[model samples]
Target: MSHVSSICLRNSAFSLLVSVFILMLTACGDLRESKVDGYGLPVVQIEMNSETLGLLLGQVTSKRPVAAEVKMQGDVKMKCEVSFAGQSSLNDYRKSLNLRACKNHPSEQTRFRLAAQNRDKTTNRAILAYEMFARTGMTVPTTELVSAYVNHDFLGVYLLTEPISSEYFHRRGIRVADIYQSKFGNAGFRKEFSSNLSEAFDYEGDGKDNYAALQGVYKTLWDNLSDEEFERRIEMQIDVDNFMSYMATAVYTAHWDGFDNNYFMALDKTKRKLIVAPWDLDRVWEKAFEFNPADFLSRNQLLFRMMTISSFRKVFASKLDLLLENFPVEVQLSNLEMKKAHSQSALAMDKVNGPDLEASFDGFEEQIKVWNEKIRTFRNTIAE
Candidate 1:
């Protein structure tokens, strides 16, 4: 009787253990499956010290970068600084992120930008703008979609890009020291030059603030001189081709934020020339496309000054026409659709109620139709 009872008890215990194992397996399977759609894109899993992250997020003015454990693709782990980035984006429904190497990662290879793309609604503008700029023979940041998780909380699909910093220059073998970022200010050349707001034009890299070169260039542009003198001096100070190409892209993309607010000037001090670069293309392909391109540059004085020069105006007009003729809108839209397809599931799962990414794509398609018609009208106006 005792042996039979013991055998029954043992069998019952085994069944219970089997049931538990099956339950555990099912739970693990769900966890793995939930994040499966997140494949194809790099998964940036951030392990944040809750207190440190809280402090970073709660700060009003002083944004102290906090350390986090960053694991990419479930393999590479590095210590990185996580900080809130952008002006309006900081106050927006979704805030952008700036990551830099705090420790362990290489100093010259560790900064990355993750844009919120809140205003963009479509989340495609940044990528489209960057690609368009790159197509115009400009050195722009490499961008991709990333599924970001902070302490197991899904932050949804983010536009992960290489920040235009010293690291960016190093990768391209460009020796640039004095890098200044543009910010909110009067779009006049003199105003931009004299802007003392730390947020207006920030010095990048660990180099000494060398404003002498930039100031000298500003003085040349500031002076009222003969068209020939102005053209020659401006060309000497800037990469005219790059500037024109940037302008053309901006006009084509209808990037209202491009000219004055969202750009960086990288000075090759030895060459004494500035390379204009694009940034923050989240506000493109909208109302500007419907309005006059000339009207869009209401505050950008440099371009206004250049418009007065017939020779420069002709070249600029030609560049705009060429970009309009060659811009691959269809291909770019296709690429955008592909990216949205890849990132849709993860973005839909965003905890912060990030906009309906799929619906935004539809809106983007409609905007493109409007943009095409407006562009044709602009071309016609310019022709006449």
Candidate 2:
């Protein structure tokens, strides 16, 4: 009986040791799976719901399915909820989806790190544009950075956005054939460029007129000219001048920033008309001023480059003329607030981590120079 008991004890001891060995290996395997770079930091994954994004931005774009994803490199993660609006067949995707305004609108995602990585001066310009667009009561999405994180991982920043069209449609109402006629002219007749400005505003001058800026800008254009056939000259200049401003801005953008993307078109829910949405704005004039003269002058020299500049100038020149003429004198005043904005952004960027932050706007001086030249031309062309 004593011998049998001794053998049972030895067998039990062997089984316990084996169990301990298996447990040790299993724990090590788990540690390996969780470890990244052997730092023992668990990897984290984060995502943004298109449905939630659609909700926050609902104020800008119509209810349509839109989406985006969030990722992290270091300790920071960001999720930007952006708004969307669409145009008919702007690209292959549009053609494939046959997208329209009320349906799926084409839009994009944004990261605040971009603003942080670039020169503060350049960054603030975009913020100003977005602010002005909103102030002008056209349409614009909210621009903001969001914060989140998981465990030890830091999710740094993202954007909270809405469509620009939401405000545009609310104010502009619907597209009138007459408004198109005034801005684009009759494709059918193509006889001469004629604009129906009066139709755009309240017929009784309650304020909003389709032909809103006509008389004011007409006078300005006339005054600036040599009075050598003022009406005809003013008319001719207005046709292409506004678009030149857009061209100048675009060229500056190409020279200044290395980025992917450009402007967008939207549907005005109120007027059911197509309109332009501000987009891919990371490229801007201030940055362009930092470019070398040779490359800078001929920046954005691509297949559609000329088209981009030409179309913008053509469309807005007429409006600029009319606006100058009709715009209230008090509203013509300017402000130095841009200086403050630039200073503030610089301070913020100084707080950002990763790669030498001061060098963020390395090529900025050149891009700024090029952009200023364009501005000079723009100012010179302004109707007296």
Candidate 3:
């Protein structure tokens, strides 16, 4: 298991022990009420039957189907199945959730993700990243801020997001022949692993062997081919523009966890080329960006190899410049400031349930300033 997963498992055990202690305290006639209140964001009230709620709580590691009614701002009501979501967020006191099969929703949107945003105290990184991608003309999931609650108990502010799927492409007037979500930690395109490549990609499309063409591309790219031939063939299969935009976004945001597994690939039928869809963006901008630009991309060998080519390297560098031009530090700070204003009040109430209630938001603000400086320094270094 991964290091984070191990920590999560240990945390889960500790949480269970804490729960037992709380029960004991209650039994001794000493009880404390939870002090969580809804944030100013639109409230997502989920009403689950007692049996279904118990079932959901019981299946902490696995997803259990629990019937629930979800209402947003007292307007949109959905009858859906609720399941705990995410790798580490499942272990959180306020767990992230996945809602599926909401009434009257499009088939592609049968599911929605409510991210816990635990890492980002600002709780705007994912939303900011998604908006940045859209501003750059990339197809990405739409996100909204919502205050989620279960059975009258306020959970906290969550980012309600649409999932990347074939239906997502259809809605955007793009036809996807195939889609694959890269497996975590196994980002390389190794032909020797072709037999099980399908398992790694997590094939999301209809066809049985849609990964066959992708495997062939991987073999041709690595095994034997002139640079010219390889570039021509690879360009035919993968959209270079899309790839550049994705890499630029990752670098600009200093997303350490982005490249390898936190992305999806779709075959756009019109272009007959692969397009990248970014995912799991909450960890971006965790610190000042000062590492070698190459360090950001060392994990994914395909992109690493492409960078060795002068022409591809030039395109990648140009994309980075364009990203810096388009998303300046001032613009990003303004966006962050707006989001902070909208969420700070909610976060204040929400933090009462977590350990960071005493922490100042000034630290987060300082980090943002550090990020802006890092971006400028990195961009200048790259230019030189």
lDDT (Cα atoms) of all candidates against the true structure: 0.67, 0.32, 0.69
lDDT score for residue 75 of model 2: 49
What is the lDDT, from 0 to 100, of the residue 67 in candidate 2?
A: 40
- What TM-score would every model get versus the actual structure? 0.81, 0.36, 0.84
Query: In model 3, which runs have C-alpha deviations exceeding 4 angstroms?
Result: 1-38, 105-108, 190-195, 207-209, 352-361, 380-384
Residue ranges of candidate 2 with Cα displaced over 4 Å:
1-125, 132-137, 148-152, 163-261, 269-272, 286-353, 361-366, 381-384
Residue 200 error for model 3, in Å? 3.4
lDDT of 3 by residue, 1-384 (tens): 544334445664323322322333223232223432456687777775545554565666786767888777455678888877776666655566788877855343567888877777667788888877766668888788887766555566788887788767787889988888877556556545556786557787785757865776687667677888888888888888888788877877777667767888888889988889998788777754345445776656678777767677777778777777777777777887788788776777664323463243555556556776766666665422
- Tens digit of lDDT per residue, candidate 2, span 288-351? 4345323432332221232234344344444434333433222222221333333333234322
Best of the two (1, 3) by TM-score: 3
Per-residue error for 360 in candidate 1, Å, reads 1.9
Off by over 4 Å in 1: 1-40, 102-108, 187-200, 205-208, 351-355, 380-384
Q: Positional deviation of 159 in candidate 1, in angstroms? A: 1.2
The CA lDDT at 282 in model 3 is: 81
Best by lDDT: 3
Candidate 2 residue 113 C-alpha distance from true site, Å: 13
